[model samples]
Target: MVSRVLVPMDDSETAGRALRYALDVHSDAEITVYHVVGSPSMMMGSAVGLALEDDIETAATERAKPVFDRAHEVAAEYDTEIETQVGLGHPTRAIVARADDYDAIVMGCHGEHSENITRGFLVGNVAKTVFERSPIPVTTVR
Candidate 1:
């Protein structure tokens, strides 16, 4: 039985769909909504700005609050509650590293930053990497 399920999410519609799918398909399992705050880089991206704060961990959590809030709202729709986790660094690595603790992983096929209109592929690098490298079974929701 899948007693624990991990659902990685971003602020994307597909991520929201993936969470709903997990809730519906594994109604009895404990769900964890995981979000990774990418490490700070010279690019000055969102995560980088957050990581530059005095309390990096706290900053990451604060950044992830909205995503978790949305997840909670989604869970409420199913009359269920879900746990949330925040991690730092590469998303694929963070997710795959934690996958061993869960029975299965469910995530969106792609993420908000991965939409490439000019390119043919829609799958995000993180999702593809996690699907290939995860130690447990993975389900991808469109």
Candidate 2:
């Protein structure tokens, strides 16, 4: 029996679907919605900006607010409350690092950037990496 579920959320349709799936299937479990900011990029703009902030944690949380808000709305639809977490650095690494604390992980097969031509036919890089590397069971929702 899974008592703790981690749902990684982004501003994507599939992410919402994943959250819904987790809530519906793990009704008796504690659900936590996680959002990652400052993920590495070729330009490193967001990550660098966050690093420059005096309060990096606060900046990251503020950056993740919109996603967390959407997750809250979804939880409301389920009539359940969920905890929210913010993480810094690479999405895949951050998720994997947190995996040991949960019984399972549920996430979108792809993310907002899946529309990129290069990634159009593949799972989002972060999701794919986490799926492969996470220590706990992972379920991906499309």
Tens-digit lDDT string for candidate 2 (53-86) = 7788888899899999999999999899999999
**lDDT score, residue 86, model 1?**
94
> Which portions of model 1 show Cα errors greater than 4 Å?
116-119
Assess each prediction's global lDDT (C-alpha) against the native: 0.90, 0.89
| Candidate 1 residue pairs in backbone clash | none
What would you estimate as the lDDT of candidate 1? 0.90
